[model samples]
Target: MASPLDRGGLPGHRVSVSPLDTAAAARHVATTEDGQRLSLAEQVAQVPTDPGCYLWKDASGEVIYVGKAKNLRARMKQYVQLTDDREKIPLMMQLVASFDYIVVDNEHEALVLERNLIGQYHPYFNVDYKDDKSYPYIAVTHGDVFPAIKYTREKHKPKTRYYGPYTDARAARETIDTIRKVTPICSATCAEWKRVRRLLDKRPDDAGIIGLICAQKGRPCFDYHVGRGPGVCAGMISPEEYAVNVRRVERFLSGHRSELTRELKEDMSEAAAELDFERAGRIKRRLDVVDGLDDRQQVVFPTSVDIDLIGFYREETIAGACVFAVREGRTVRTCEFIVDKGLDVAEDELVAGFVKRYYDETADIPAEVDVAVDLEDADVIGQWLSAKRGRKCTVHRPQRGEKRHLLETCERNARHALMRYMMRTGYADDRTNQALLQLESALALDGPPMRIECFDISTLHGRFTVASMVVFTDGRPDKSQYRRFKIRTELDEANDFASMSEVLGRRYAPERMADERFGSRPDLLVVDGGKPQLTAAMRQLEQLGLDIPVCGLAKADEEVFVPWDDTPVVLPSGSASLYLMKQVRDESHRFAITFHRELRDRAMTVSVLDEVEGVGPTRKRAIMRHFGSMKRLRAATVDEIAAVKGIPAAVAQAVYDTLRA
Candidate 1:
């Protein structure tokens, strides 16, 4: 007995098609070179003694590495003369056939160009993320009246400021959670906060109403009694006051650890002077969080100065960077980045290259940077960092002192990270390779399912139709290749069949085969359903005159459906092959759910506003700010609405009429 969703029917599926893919396509990255072969030494001889970025091409003349230099000649010399300092140097030099350099106005320009080229080329030797969204940002949705500090991915959105392309998503979230202990900001979506806000604002004096709403919200959200919220939803804190709290969070995350604490202390004293006990206590708690962390920082200097101590280590199989974020004379946090260079690259170049990638991806950069590696073009790197920070920056290898000791500590950390990376990669490879092999044998495919793609559609009662395409490369999430869609179909009824058809059709459409999302066809395509869904996917591939293995993982009894078979192929329960299938299916479901929630939340806020002719975003903000709540504006007399600063009498009357209707 199979449930409807797990069987031949798809009663709860949809096509999520969005016009937003156009914006994503605009950021499409590709290599700039024509794969021209040139002599390495000859090209190096032509390089000027000026600041610039250089690209090293393999024998095939494809860029394997990108590096920047203060003096092009001095930096290029390091590559030609191999050093035992790096194990990869000999290997890289063997492959070096030709190279090119982009002359820039300054070291700053060179650094910027290096980043751009790496993003475009994704050189094998550069520290690059497999997926764009791999780094998570603690995003403040300042675009909304009630901003929330939450985990958000960066894709350059408007009105929202992002912090840290934090290398570790868990660490980023942990930092935010710790911040909430001192200055509580809303973690809810704008619509959710707005609903609670309206209720509390309209009944400002009603303590009972606040209790009822907060209780209904349960333990997970906005507990004013526990002070997990700044009392915003209950109208206990003014919007202006909440903005100040959010600013503190921004400053803390922006690497202003010492400066932010001083401000918090001053603000606490002011609150105490005014006899605002609660406000003073809240500020004190924030001070405690800043002062009380187990930072493991040895007091190197009595006076505080911002610095980032960096070190790198390379093993036969793996290489890594250890970055100690020293703020106000203390090491506040440590970040480690490790990657397997496809081609052998020298350790010195790797350190320089990693530094560029890290600072470019993250918002936090220090005024003074100390490195264990010589970094040949330290002055150029410092100049570029200075420009980025709108202040002076110094990048240098430390002489004997506390700075040298810190670099030693950073190097030790890098060694530990290298060991961990080696262990993890070996274990991960065994599990993933075994799973892929098992999956291949079970499916009887042409080869291992190294790159498997799963598609799942999500919608709420035919609203905000959306779909997710999740990619797993080598049996690990390749988030960079993940694609999202908002489907457009004129259906009087919800149809999983049609939704699957539309999403699959658009994905494999002849024009899309050359597109990055579709150009690299998956080794295996797994749809989230049974016979009908499997057929819908196969039909699309057939229409496109393509032949790729397709299957469906029906939720009912964990049955799998292949095009050639009428009956399902149910893998052994709890088997590794089946677990791999379930993992992909679940991931697609989760990705689709998040997109669906975002769309629904957006509609809850914008649909009503969109209907009001006189109320664009500007006018609407004024109205919300003026009345404090939409409930108030709905009940307001025309004169009260007209009295709002930005609204004319005619506009106010129109707004009043619209709300009344």
Candidate 2:
């Protein structure tokens, strides 16, 4: 094995530990000593004058950066010369890692790979980084039973109407909002409105129903009010109409671009014939927008069965694979994930592995499987799945036809889609999205909160009290950042406020928050409650001198609160901001309740066993395991319980008596 000192003679070798500059790192790789298999001059002698991607790695076989080169030889030589300033090349060179290159046939391929790799490894110093702002998509929940149109940075649902994957989310949102003003679909579900109308027309203690009726009927909603008049939504769209619109959206999202295009065109013509120029203009513009989108689709075909098509490419540690599921040849699910590949697996295998891992437990699966490359054991997987579901399962790798071309086009799309998602989520290059960027802006903080701590408390009958703290970095959930605390300080009493304070104190007591990897002072703190709870949190932070700006989410009113602020900031109840807070609060609640239930169940389950002197936890576990669940155990005959590995008949009889009593 090569000693660490083997890198001592490399240029900029000692400067890597300091603050790293991305541009400087790229520059350093360009000028550093040739740690290649051949000398710089020798490698340059054979350099191919082709467009391709160049890779730079440190001595330890880690990808530090990936770049595209229009001229492989020239780009390679620039690094060989070592003439750049130390400031530019300093940190990257300090690692003095070896490097490699792949010569693609064209600059486009190189560009594609460069984006793919950067997104995959997210090297510390790769410039031209992609951010979420660079990709956006239009979301039409209108695909669901009660559809709401919106814009999304990332889609969580498949087969939803998603437009663009646009380079600008704000623009997309503005456009969609404008369109919504023209068409105000009722936000209330059929069930909700029906219940409300029934209760208002008759019943009253159903104040919740009455409140909803008043809210919807007192004035035109924001969407309707935005348009010319209350006439926009004088009557809620009937279920039939809603279903028709949903089917149209489904068709559009299923990759039936022409269907969406046709609808837009028809709407435009109808508006024109009705002498509604403004409405006509809206429809016309939408037509143009849909047309523009349709033209951008890499594959356009009409078919029946839904299928997920996938493809892949890789350079060293960085690999890129794209998966696009097509329903009747229209793309329903287009996604890409960046991963590392040390094994020499085929691109097809990589795609398959990703599909399995990603959709392992997914509730939705396409009807057909499509691919660009065939797997060796497709039958094994297909058979296993078929037997499991009692359905015919076939995996097809199309060759030499429209299907093949479609698959290939989908593969290309998958590549770009993966790259775009990586960039948007800041996942390419294995980096966290600045979750705190929004938090900082919302709170006006000096810097991004590298560590964000949110606390939630859960209790049942003032027993089994528990609190959980969930961490978010860069706007995404980080499970590793999660921490849980059992309410131990006050055993017999459940004081949520005190429990919260104790958990927060335990988490930040220097001994916990002082670890560099695990320890960073939160720029922002959130508590899962309204004003009073927030006040309690503030006092705790103040007492600790943590002095972090704290806020609380009120579940009842769906408001965000800062202490001393009289009026709570009310975010749109369904806005992404609200959604995020809901997720955080829900996660914290889930974690706390999960821990609480474990304690409660453990005590509850074992107490019944412990009442029997001869029975212990081991024998109890054996009985429960054999019986499957508590219900089964309760219903099991004493003889059946006794048959469990270690439970004696007397112990089983005692347990039976204890449970019955």
Best by TM-score: 1
Query: On a 0 to 100 scale, what is the lDDT of residue 534 in model 1?
Result: 91
TM-score for candidate 1, residues paired by index: 0.48
Give the TM-score of each candidate.
0.48, 0.38
CA lDDT scores, all candidates in order: 0.72, 0.59
lDDT of candidate 1 over 407-441, digit per residue (tens)? 88888888787678657757446656877888887
Model 2 C-alpha RMSD vs. true structure (Å) is: 30.6
Per-residue lDDT value at 136 in model 1: 76
Minimum summed lDDT over a 10-residue window in model 1 is located at 14-23
Clashes of 2: 21
lDDT of 2 by residue, 1-661 (tens): 1212132212222112101124354344434456323444454545567776666677776777665577877876666565533232444555645555656655544544454555556664453212323345566653333455556655346545455443344655565543443333443333443343455446645443433445566444454554422221334444456566555544554455566667778888898899999978866765665566545544545545556665665532245556665654555445555545412334554555554433332323455577666765566455544543357656678777766776677657646755665567545334323334444565566776665678988877678888888887655678987877777665566677888778777776767767775647776788998888888887777777777878898888667887657788765322335555666787878888898888898888777777877877677677777887778888988888778887778888888887888
